[model samples]
Target: MTCPPPTATLRPGQLRDPFRLLMDVTARHDGLVRLGRGPLGVYIVSHPDYIRRILVTHSGNYIKGPLMKPFRTALGNGLVTSEGELWKRQRRLMQPAFHVRQLQLMESVIVAAVDRAVDRWAAAAETGRPVDFLDDCIELNVEIVLGALFSTSIDPARAQRLRELTSEVFAGLASKVWTFFLPSWFPLPGVIRYRRAVAALDAEVHALIAERRAAESTPEDLLGLLLDTVDAETGAHMSDQQLRDEIFTLFMSGYETTATGLTWAAYELARHPEIAAKLAAELDGATARPRPTFAELRSLEYGKRVIDEVLRLHPPFPIWFRSTVAADDLGPYHLPANAKIVLNPHMTHRDPAYWSDPETFDPDRFTVGRFGTEQRHAYYPFGKGSRMCIGERMSQTITQVALSAFTGTFEFSVAPGFEVVPQYVVTCQPKGGLPLILRRR
Candidate 1:
């Protein structure tokens, strides 16, 4: 019986900055390393083949790991954190709603939402004031997703409240990741706050569900789709609680990740004028109209690449987790049953072996015929396999529309002395927000 590589015990300070520590370990150990010991053991797998095996090839042999256990209170057994038969059922029922044809129906909502944001930025640009691009992107994404999903818009006060509450919930959840062994009922301040925030969020979701339920005519949206979908085997529909969990999961997963990706893209574009210019030119050449149609969006090849490059550099969910259900062989390492496995897309994305000059930001690396075939698994921002993000098409469309609108109308540069650092909460966000000065294009 071959043993796994020796565990590399993390220093106390290293635990506080898991991203950096994990990256260091990946670099030193050639993309596969063990950390911790015995019951608390974790294997960090960064190689593409290992990631493919764990996520796709032998996925049934694993389950969502302890890292996601902390999120269950807030996210419940929705697609983001659920496993087993329940996940399979939910995935089947929800799959159609995110299909490409269904997503096309929401394109107008996306365009309108982005137009509203562009109008807001136009005023800011006219006043020569800097805007927090990250905040604006988050707001735009939340509104677009809400409109697309429910055919409803959140008022400013409600939107602000929801934003604050969700932020608190995410912060609280992130605080518990490393200390996942602790019981949620332990009455810790962070845990208590997380529960409260979840409750508040639940109230909002329940209100939406009630509103939809009471409607005389069901709208053509994701909410309606969920309310109407029936389990063929069980002949039952999602209960209110189940509806709340799914909606809440979609609410967070749908908006936050895309918002972060767009925010990073905007930040990069602002910092790199040449790339921004090329992207804007591509958009301009694609269509003379204010908004690109679904066909036109596909035609904006460079714009798509820009978004891909941004996701590669700053994946919203930086690390994905899984746990082995039985002892497995991961290359030379013996992965024991029930051991935690961490796949760091962030580290693998920047590995010198896979990406040349990986630290530099170059959109051209993703250009057609330039992006090599060797890095297929190396570039999965939405993850890979059947469990890949269901909202992948919707997210890309939202970002593409938002980017076209923003770049077509304005040019933004990062404000002086504004340091941008990736803060890993529930997602990788730009710390202190992305403050940028805008000029009308």
Candidate 2:
């Protein structure tokens, strides 16, 4: 309980692939390690024990911290960046919209969006054209999220513009992370563009809110539900700015995560035909039609396992950051207040101690009665504890339904000598996008 945890020095340019380097360092150092030196050095914690400590047991002593300060600038005081009382209130108000019953009501919106995208994929399949699977998934998720929020209010052009603006904003924010040492007064193009993107997005979202406010009646959708939400204590309805912030938070959190998961799923399915056949068989036996209702889709046992394995292997949000509020010890090693802690679920998910044959594409790993308590605690594709993803149910539904529609109606293939590398950015995704050849089943 006395010696310090091993520290690994990061060479120049290694930040480009930090997750990979982190995995190597942490695995070699017994599930924990420090990178670099001084105040800027980061502590990488892959051990479930320390992760549960920071996120759950002693969650009160850890905050999203300075690591998430940039998001506050980009997204304002939304749930993702807000802390303490503000976060608690926002979570309470938002919880009901993602409830099981609410998500059930939104199934039609999810299915309809997937169907339209599949129709386009079908046309490409008939012509033997290779489709960018990631792009298709990204576009589909945008529709699903927007349709759930606005009912049928947002048209294609508006959706595309929103997508472009968000993409720009995220790109700008990520670029700024590497230049944190620079002065705020520095003339950085990314920061300037990020500011412009946020402004344009705010104008667009505010206009949408004003239209709903002036309407004779609001439609039954996420925006309408949120518009009517009143604080139990304050009795105050959400202001225009609050609604815009929540909308921005929901979109930023939802689309890319679901899209990245589906993209990895397709890549794995194409690479493993036997597993794909088993999944298709289960799909065929369980689902009586091309499209499954919410109930029918949940009954696909093997399909669910495939989804589980996909998430374990390719978690969308691979790593998250938190900082200590005061001095604390993780088992033996001690960390001072404001210590930058990087929790990498990507490493823990594949630890051989918790998983068998860690690198294999085996959905059966998630089959019934296979996991011990340690393995269960060690797996966290949706994160752990109080601040776990708010839209877990909605994200899973979108993912499962999209997988059903795509696999149920088509066959996926790749070039003979193709390879895909993982791109670790804001979200973990397949590098160079996934280009797959599709054919109708």
Candidate 3:
């Protein structure tokens, strides 16, 4: 049997920057490239066909892989981290909450959250203070997610505290993914901090759950849906622990990913005033009121393309992993049982073979009627197949609404000499935050 393409061993310095290292390896090898040695073997799949095979066609041959293990402490068996029948059950129970029709019900709630942020940003713009654009996105997204889930707004102080803690916890989890050899049970300072952060986040989620249970009425929000959902097969409802885990998982997965997407949209728009102007024009023409309704959001074609391009350029979850359940042949390579595979959308989306002018920030690449068949699997920001993000529709709606509100009301320019570096923590975030000057339009 033909051996897989030779593994690209990492140099010591390359280990420090895995994203760059992976990019270099993908550029050097063909569609399939193996890395590392022994039981730690990794196959980095870059081609869309192989990606489709692994994530979709042959999905049952793999599972969530080892990379997601560390996140279990914080995420529990919630949809994002869980596997097997449990994942299916939770996904089914929570699926309706993200349906387009269901999300439309929360349109006013989303608008209210965005309005609150716009009010704050207007004040900042008036003062001529440079706002951390990414931080602002985070706050707005956190508020939006919480309000959507609970149908109530959280205290600003408490929301800020939860944001910091969740960031710490996820950063710790990302570090653990990179340093797989380090024992999480080692009780290092970072590990201790991660535990504390998880505990704090859990406390907040549990408190919300408790308050909801004791209240006289619960709105038909996500939390209420999860609490009310009963399994068709077993006729069982989620327990309090299950509810807490799912709620926290949904909050973390939904908020951070959406915020990251919006942040990158803002970053890209600020960098390209021409594109920003187009988006602003589309937003202005799409609505006469302060906020667009759900139908109006669908009409903002240019705005949607801008967001699609932003997600293509900077996917929040840049890397995904899956492990082989048994020895099998993949393309020209023969893989042994339990071999790890890495799917890098970051590399695939930028592959020159699929995207013209891959390095350029051109939203027109996503313009309707311009994309080709190959682009289907070439751009998977929210992933593909059965395990695709259940929150994809809601995220898109949240991002479209938030971006329209902010870009329509204000003009944003990056702070002079501010360099944007992509930091791959749990999510790819703009390093040092995105500082921008906002002027009310």
RMSD of 1: 2.0
Clashing pairs in 3: none
Point out where model 2 deviates above 4 Å: 177-189
Candidates in order: C-alpha RMSD to true structure = 2.0, 1.7, 1.9
Clashing pairs for predicted structure model 2, backbone only? none
Q: On a 0 to 100 scale, what is the lDDT of residue 395 in model 3?
A: 89
At residue 245, candidate 2 shows an lDDT of: 88
Q: Give the TM-score of candidate 1.
A: 0.94
TM accuracy, model 2: 0.96
Count clashing residue pairs in model 3: 0
Enumerate clash totals for all models, in the order shown. Answer: 0, 0, 0
- Looking at model 3, residue 143 earns an lDDT score of 78
Query: Candidate 3 residues 263-323, lDDT tens each?
Result: 8999888889898898888877878877688888878878888888888889878888788
413 Cα displacement, candidate 1 (Å): 1.1
lDDT tens digits by residue: candidate 2, 1-441: 655667898888887776688777877876778888885588889888988998899999989877776676677878888899988888888887898888977888998899899899999999887898988898899888888999888888888898888777776666665443344466776576788888998899999999999998888899999999889988988889878889988878875899999999999999997878787888888867887789887688888889999989998788887888998889888887888888889889989888999899888888667866888889888878999988888888899999988888888887555688887667888777888999888
TM-score of every candidate relative to the true structure: 0.94, 0.96, 0.94
Worst 10 residues of 3 by lDDT: 180-189
